[model samples]
Target: MTTVIFVHGTGIRQREYNDTFEIIEQKIHAQRPDIKVAPCLWGALGAKFNENRASVPLEDGTLALSQGEEDADIVLWGQLYRDPLYELRLLSLKPIKSRNPFGEKPGDILQSRVASLTPTLELEANLQEAGIAEIFAQARDTVIRSQPYKGALLTVSESDLSEYYAAIARAIAAQAMFISELQEKFPPILTDAQLRDKVVELLTLALTEAKLGLGGWLLKPVLGLAQHGGTNYIRRNRVELTDKISPMPGDILLYQTRGEKIRQFIQEQIAQAEPPVVLLAHSLGGIACVDLLVQQQLSGVELLVTVGSQAPFLYEINALYSLEYGQLLPEHFPEWLNIYDLRDFLSYVGNKIFPERVQDVLVDSRQPFPRSHGAYWTNAKTWEAIISRLP
Candidate 1:
């Protein structure tokens, strides 16, 4: 029997993580019953370090005298910044506003506009004469709220505010230009009243498109702001960021590498298993596994499977443990298989970076961004790849 040890990613609640593991185990067992799957359960150990308590009604419909709650069980404190107030503040950054209007670059926006434009340059010129330039500038300026006083509440610095507004302006300009081209294609047969209505409809559509484009750019910075604030909040509450239920991915990586609990658990599990170990790790878990293999010079790992991992990027940034700035892959490093979807921004190709004994497979996961990252377990291609590689 092949012993498959599963390691999960960061930011997962304990119960949710366990449920996911169970689902994956069931799928794997259906194909290969001889394979015995076991969860590393490092997340539970991580959660234990930051336990809390809350009153809860029992099965008898009475509150327990002493209640026990794992830090991981509390979702609110873990995701406080998800609140509307914080989100609105984060979205107030100028760069965020600009990027939020349009997701593509000016060139892409222009190309798309030109592609969709009517062949008549005269109509296009007339549309350009429709006062769109002024509207575009106004729309862009409004994307980011301009009150410097509001920044005090959001904790945005003056310089950042300026930069944010400038980005929003640029995005608005690009979007306006794109929309102006479409405005020219308005039906020439319309009467004065009809033309007024048509122009309103076109301008409204253009503004919406501009916002959509800018929204994509705004997302990253907004997320960064939330993460920074969230970390500070966790620290201020006398909670070690790592011990918090929903620690940042970077913090989770640090704990997995330097902390004793998770490493010890994996060591214990490996020592007792009789069959060759097939290690399956996802996202941050993959990074932790690589750290363990390198730092401990661990042996007996027959195969390593990583899905939706940032290992390649992390390695390039000198984040992985036991791997030095310029060191090559160790001779004892186990054969590895990496699975990733192109839509998952966190996932990257590993074989190009680590050529020896490593194979990277790109699987099409039709899910949207973020969802694509977590879709690997349920994806048929992912399972088939793992099962075929089993020794």
Candidate 2:
């Protein structure tokens, strides 16, 4: 009946993200296994640079890092999740290099077959059961007539022709799956991407039988067009720079400019959760949770638990995105629970500023400043405070 969304703060990379999440999850479930703990891992979307902070300079007015040759799928999926037509649009940007002046233009082959694609397999039952049997046909056409689809076909060749149809199948299926996946009754064996890829494989085989290369696998054609990109560096650095010195502060800097992606991800988690959801946010994650809930009311959210968060600080300085200095917490804002430690400079009390709207609880980890900031997870008193307040 209740879900706790563990919203982690800045600098917690992927590996640490998993480990830290497990720590809290196991601890919570140990006491109350009935409660579900969801992970809100938004660090990767935070600020990062492949050029290695090229924008930041030292005491002297010189660049910090040198240039690199090349570096990214989470990046693609991030865009894809937001816009189902994203990959189709990206494919359209590619110049068509096909010069096949042979029998049956590859474009025609694509349009003809693409319109009628259906799953002959058992998955068909799930589609029919979900009352979405026409999902494939609709998805296929949606991809075909799209501006990107037309553009991709304009100068295309036999080799890459299959790729376009497959992409259409993928885009359409992605949207359908995105909606259907939320239905607990119709569980999918394959993920949305996986299902699309499987269907694309079948289509690829059929197209190949028709005496066209279709570029072998759809993955190659999709990835071949894109070289190294900046987001790829975000992943690369997370892997390569695993040391403590690595800065994840870019999250704070980037969130101001590109906060929607992070907020949307949180919202998606909220959507998946049952009602009476509690957001257990830390640091910048707390800021994001505040910003999102402030702008619009999320149905299930009941309380926001901010551990050493800067949401109040940001609001005090008039820097909080959703609420300015003179503004008050929205009338519909969810209940707030702010946790702070005097030892941790990053932690701030919300009671003084927001009054009854938020309650600030102090639990000292005895560790000084920066160490105290991260010690909240390890301290018993912190968990005691958190557990006592959970709905």
Candidate 3:
């Protein structure tokens, strides 16, 4: 029997994780019952956050619960909310020998102070209540106004301001405990204006040191918000699931912590299965699969299919574990086919990046942004591509 291993992407909750893959498995089974399907479920180990219900207006002029079984909350909130925070923290923590007049690098000094502060749950809520977004916007405007180009010509779309919002949110959340203490310590003297100025200063410094260009700043927040939202949904519905999946911390960090579990699972599956195995990986799963083939040097995969994955982009940023800088593609790499939808912002082309034995195919899922990312599982073209390539 042909062992078909399925790998899922980010922000999947315990309640619906199996169903997400089962949907694809059922499709594949209906076409080829002879195939054996197994899923590598790692989303159960993702970070948990609280979910709050909000009514979203539909096109039909009715309201609906934003959280759905197949909703994009995992990708939207986990990656978006936590990724930027992780990046900023990493950037600020980088060791620098250069010292300013204060005998410390500006970035290091500021981050050290921010890190020293302890955040409480109550403080986090208070900061959120204080309108952190407005404080960030005002600071950003001031910074733009002081630039060479007048503020009139500096234009940033709402979409572009996503990362800034996320970064601001994270910074606030991280430092909330300290801010609350400060408020309590100086309730009579500390004013809202002073607090706002402090937040702007902290965020501006963090952004500048991170070297996130205007575009990066914008994109990070948008992605972070999605990740934050998705994680919250998972946390909210965590108790409702029959199968209990433990919560893990960090979006990208989860890869480091739980990647071995997935890798071992795939390895065990391949070892027991017959030769010419067909491995189908989606989203972060694709990244893990590539790392196994290229880095771990695992073999026996006949055909490797990656759908709607961020592998190419992640590699460019040097994020892939096995595929490091200046490394050549493995000689024993399996024949690879990458499928992506144009509207899926997270999906990217891998042929150019790994041209040795890779074929990049683009499909029109015709679904909206985040929906397009998950649509590949059910798309006729995706199934056709997988079936045609199976030996």
Candidate 4:
């Protein structure tokens, strides 16, 4: 069968990710029925990879690849092991073939000799040859930097992984129930800082419980993104900045059940699909797509529509981070809508009406109910505006 593998990326729960994909599928199938659509969930907190590998290395030298599914062609994408395997395969190649080559041709001997010698040295070398060792080593660290996080790392006793998997299952199940509720509610009005805090908390909790041992490495960037997102959300909403700013948005919005992770999963699904996949990410999700496109991590996101989004602000926020580190913004942002609610604090924020910043459409949503930062996507007006953008 011809297959479209939807690879969900980082930070999202699976069920909500699939819901967004289902929304896109509905739009596409209405026009064309021959295509098959599927969401290949990569699970959260790198869980899918971990689960695939099964036995992770513990404080003890022993490790196992946990679940017993030994099929080599697991995902069928071929992207998973191709590059690494190809590099390894190159190591086994023989550059020079010698039968009685003690005194063969000099020219062939000189060039072939060096090529043969190179692989010999390369094979015996450390994992730096593959270049993934550092990341793996960091993943193996035993101690965490903070004491408060000790309980988190330790929570993932061997028996706890099954529970962690179950918890993720529960998180995704709860999100599935909550999604439709989101469609009807007004967007919440938490500042970017507030949103970031929530994301950080959820991520910390998730990582801690899972025993990923990646807290220190993941914390700053995660917090930074959340805060940056929160700040950008406020600036985009045009909430009047106090002389002394109040709380920043937390990392996780808590309402939509981790929008960034869901957004990443959707785009990843799009990237893995056959041509003609439609994608609709509300608010920060659109921001995520723009970032994905900019990073060249995904492509071919046909019929992309973002409801109540803040794509431009992401550029600015990324620019702010890049400036702080003396780096350059990589590429131009993509084309998408910036749906806004006039009454919503996030809607009044910076460059809200400007079209030059990647097809900005200042959508005015008349929220039928009281809402905050997370409610903007659920507003009926927002959906109506988005329907116009869908193919």
Give each model a TM-score.
0.52, 0.52, 0.50, 0.33
Count backbone clashes in candidate 2.
0
Predicted candidate 2 versus true structure: per-residue lDDT over 275-338, tens digit per residue: 7899999999999999999987886899999999999988999899999998888888998999
**Predictions: Cα RMSD each:** 17.8, 19.8, 17.7, 27.9
lDDT of each: 0.58, 0.71, 0.58, 0.37
Candidate 4, residue 261: the lDDT equals 55
Candidate 1: where are CA atoms >4 Å away? 47-245, 248-257
TM-score ranking, best first: 1, 2, 3, 4
Q: Point out the worst 10-residue segment of candidate 1 by lDDT.
A: 67-76
Q: Whose TM-score is higher: candidate 2's or candidate 3's?
A: 2
- Model 3 weakest lDDT span, ten residues long: 147-156
Model 3, span 209-320: residue lDDT tens: 3432223433454445544555444454544431233232244567766677666766776777776688788887788788888755556688889998888888778877
Question: Judged by lDDT, which candidate is best?
Answer: 2
TM-score of 1: 0.52
Candidate 4 regions with alpha-carbon error over 4 angstroms? 1-43, 46-267, 297-299, 314-333, 347-355, 362-365, 368-384
Worst 10 residues of 2 by lDDT: 63-72
State each candidate's clash count. Answer: 14, 0, 18, 48
